[model samples]
Target: MKKQYKRFRLRTVSAMVAMAFVANAWAVDPFTVRDIRVEGLQRVEPGTIFASLPFRIGEQYNDEKGSAAIRALFGLGLFKDVRLEVNGDVLVVIVEERPTVADVEFAGSREFDKDVLKKALREIGLTEGRPYDQSLADRAEQELKRQYINKSLYGAEIVTTVTPIERNRVNLTFTVTEGEPARIKEIRVVGNKAFSESTLRGLFDLDTGGMLSWYTKSDRYSRAKLTADMEALRSYYLSRGYLEFRIDSTQVAISPNKQDITITVNVTEGERYVVSAVRLDGNYLGKEDEFKSLVTIKPGEAYNADKVAETTKAFNDYFGNFGYAFANVEARPEIDRANNRVAFVLVAEPSRRAYVRRVNIAGNNRTRDEVIRREFRQFEASWYDADKIKRSRDRVDRLGYFKEVNIETSDVPGAPDQVDLTITIVEKPTGSLQLGAGFSSAEKLALSFSVKQENAFGTGNYLGVEVNTSKYNRTIAFSSVNPYFTPDGVSRAVDVYYRTSRPYEDQGGNYQIATAGAGLRFGIPFSELDTVFFGGALERTEIKPGTNIPAAYLAYAERFGYKSVSVPLSIGWGRDDRDSAIAPTSGRYQRVAGEVGVAGDTRYVRSNYQLQQYIPLNKQFTLAFNGELGWGKGLGGQAFPVFKHFYSGGLGSVRGFDQGTLGPKDVTGSTIGGPKKITMNAEVITPFPGAGNDRSLRMFGFIDAGNVYGENEKFRLSELRASVGVGLSWISPIGPLRIAAAHPIRKFPGDRIQRMQFQIGTSF
Candidate 1:
């Protein structure tokens, strides 16, 4: 009976205690506030805290209002903690403010630049002077890790340290350990039936390390490069008639140490297809036969996706010629599964013709808008023609002021038939300062330099100055060109130069020539691919007597005087259709120029014609041929001037022979004036081995033949010297670089040979 009574008493006490606790937790009483006070703020003002409170100085305060004020104040992200204290007729608010970020620093960051990392962090709301939070620091570390991973730096580690500085601030220091980039150890291509594994892997830019891995960097594992390689592999098969080919899966695996990687690509190669027939199914605007002529796909040939794509593009371009800016051309293949043959039907939809509403030039931050706009052939409010638009883009690109140029057409709102053409360009530095030095056994140490500005002061005018300090060759030259000298794109160039050519380094030559000249040239556009040039120059030549002057030079000086003044006139015609000035793939260029000394002590006529053709055999191979013919004749029974002679043999003429050493030599072992010259070059060009698809660097095997004929000698094939060699060409940062190793196939007894030659800055 006593134990039961004690249990009943304990239960009653527990119930009473629980009821008191519930009332204290959920119950609140309404009160009227007389005043409000805020404390514990370093930078934030008291008014800011007061405004954040739900209840004002004289407003009524209740449990809901108190909860709202607390919530609102915390949402500002300014305070680390907040508290509320109530005294009789007074409300006190106390808060702990979050520290501001004082400074952000980076250490051991080699892969990514410090400014780059800071900028990225700033984008994620982690800049200095902002409120610092631990969660934000964690997020920043993760973000940096993600960036490193994209660069294939799997072993990279980021450690963020936060240190409290003076005046309620903290400094963030991100210490990074970026290890070596992951390398591609293996690449396995599975289920390729038509092509061998090695052949398929050859199409990829990412591969196992090779002998030239340091240069090509193909051994590195890059996600972006891998994606591009996959696309190339697909194109290779698609262009080779495997229309149904598909990549089933791709797996990229990293080793435990994060230093090695392997890629596995599984693909299904379907049956090869042949083109049974090709039909055009669109209104070619009364030019069906013309469009048909543009088709490169033959009916009896194998199905080539490239040919089909080309045909479709040709149809679209043809439609665009008729003012169809929104042309839709598609090649729909009709597959015959049983016979393994495909028939392609080209369908075109030429929507309403569009007139250009506006021609906009964008991304010309450094260049003037007029500079880019003047290159446009398609005008505002004119009919849209694809060919003209393409030409405009190419013209702007050819200016060499931009790294990239793109054109986009947008349909004007509420005007379905009108479109706005926007030309976008990425500007590059047009000013160049080149300083170079070279050494050779014969030429000794030579120093050369030039300062050039293609777009001087954003005016699209070229200015250049060159100086050579070589012991054998000393020159000073100044040149300028104004491309917009005339409204019709006629260019004008002015040049002034002083040159002294000596035959001996010790200044022991019997004779030396000093020339001071100035010329003005103008280029008149005759057509899209042709130009006519006219120029005149006045030159003063002084022959300095020395020890071992050639007999011919002495005789001429005696008859014409040591000092002679000549007025030369020049006229020329040129055409250029090559794709790139630095690396031409397919096109033909021809030029013919003639110069005559009409009013001077020396009277002569000199003419030269040059032709170049580049033929693309495939994406990887090219055949280039160059031929030149030069002739000179003296007027009024005088011999051709010694300095005006044409000499061959060198890097620019015939390799394997010494420079200007291929003509007839006098008794003093010096090459004299020549009346006739002929030179020819044939090259089989290919992409550099292991550099895969890099057009900037290429390799070629060349055959060169050239010879100079003296005044009495006639042009003959037997007199021509020949050479065969392998060479390399690279478009370097400053200019084009070429190197050649040659062997003379046909040479005379006294022919001087220079088997290895290199040039730093010159065009192909």
Candidate 2:
């Protein structure tokens, strides 16, 4: 429109000039003498035109300057074009304007969503019904293509189709084509020294074949997998004594098909060193002997960095126990190159003797922090006690509420001589219940039951009932434990029980006996994890002399009293840190109980002691050992108590033996009471998911060695009964279900058959 107006005005101006030229023959010099006049501009006001012109009215009307002024006015984007006319001292400027845009629209764009497509077009400044351009339309198509590529659509195509509409306008539609995503087809591992190809392949999440591979995203070539694979490789070597090793380089190669990936890791293996000696290097403030006592490493041993680190830690801890919160210990090594040995030099520095600023407990979701805090001996604003911190860790660990307990220390910010301790924990189920049923040979068609709530009602209290029934006799019991019996941390317990069972007779005969008892027990802490308990019980026992009953038992019972009522006082000491109540991997537990018939009218005093300890054979295996000793002697010419007699060859007592059919046999071939018995067992536990690390809820192979002899028989290791087998167990709501198919490795002649047994809830 602007160009057309310019042509029209040029014609008019030329015509006027031509006519003036004709009228001014021989007087051309007179044209510039008259006044200038303007015409044909509605918006281009005359005052605006004069302001735009470089020449004044009195100046020469040169065509170059006059035309330049008109071009400048049209370029303001305010005018479509400006026309100039020069007619005998008259200048005319005519302008035509362009139309404005109102709105823009899109249709059928689902691939890139409308908003994103709109943004793509806005980059080129195209929107609404704004003044459109062919250049912006072309650029918009390219911009949309770039966006699609980012979504992995390398084969994507974009087309912008413009439609002309009413009043010199058009509509633009960006059409796109999105292609399929590329999938990885294969993966390969390279440069493995510590393991085989199949082993290494098993370590990687990425794999070559399987229908479910796509769901697991195992076929995707990812840097994350590569990094994790490297770590796995590193751990495998480190665990095998390849400590000084490094992964030199790694390469990820994509196949020509672009769907397969191959990874290669190059590693460097360094020399393995042995520890020759350890010597302290730093000033111990003339207390070298005291610090030296903390060293635990042996001189002529393989280099165990862990032990050295532990020794240094012990030194630091000892300092902290004496109010030095910032004690530091560093282990420096001097290599004996010629002898292929390494010597360690220990250094200790006490940076500061600081006080405790705060002690915070964290990561306890179910247990209250106060419950744990009460166990601490270290107080805020008091001198930091490393010993207390360790004790605190032990206290929390002993609670059986966490899988791991860790303490993190940091200097109180802006406080030079203050420290804050954070106890971070990984909470576990402190409460456990096992409900199960099983059958055994000795206890034919037996049903074992137990209901124990370790953390009863979420308060860390305990209550339980346990019963084992057989054709012979059934025993029922009820027990309660208040972990925090008193505000001062003493523990209290109550137990009530009744048992009625026919004593299994071998040769003579079988008979029935019934017994009931009640007791109150109180515990005082000997240490954070140790406790001493004292209790008194009133027990009544009635013995029905059987034809199979050992002559000695009957003879003694006749003198003790047909139905005896006795009150007994018992004292016991227990300390347990094993990870589990039934089975432990890395912890130890001990129990010793003895009772004397002080208050009871019985003529005998009876006592028993059982000690158990657990040690980890590996991350997945635990070794457990146990021993038992018991004795009952006549008092005031009276007989021993029948209910407290020792019985063995059961699920908990012996793996392959039948329940309650073990002990000293009567003269009539009945296995009767024994004055004492001893037992031992070893187990290897493995994991089965859906169950936590409760030893009772795992699959394991075990070797049990022990036997129950007569009460008067001497304990000897050579006479121990040994049983070996694989067992399966899991926690049920009623009790632990443990089924072991065992073979008695060593059994005496005429011993009862105990090939396989299923026992629910047995503790060793």
Scored by TM-score, the top model is 1
Instruction: Give the range of the ten consecutive residues with the poorest summed lDDT in model 2.
Output: 1-10
TM-score of each: 0.86, 0.62
RMSD for each of the candidates: 7.5, 17.5
Q: Scored by Cα lDDT, where does model 2 land?
A: 0.68
CA lDDT of each prediction against the hidden true structure: 0.84, 0.68
Give per-residue CA lDDT, model 2, range 416-482, as digits (tens).
Answer: 8988989898877755455545554555567677877776655777889898777776889999988
Q: Taking the candidates one at a time, how many backbone clashes does each contain?
A: 4, 23
lDDT of 1 by residue, 319-420 (tens): 887789888988889999999999988887787899999998889888999888888889998899999999899889889999999999999999998999
> What TM-score quantifies how close candidate 1 is to the native fold?
0.86
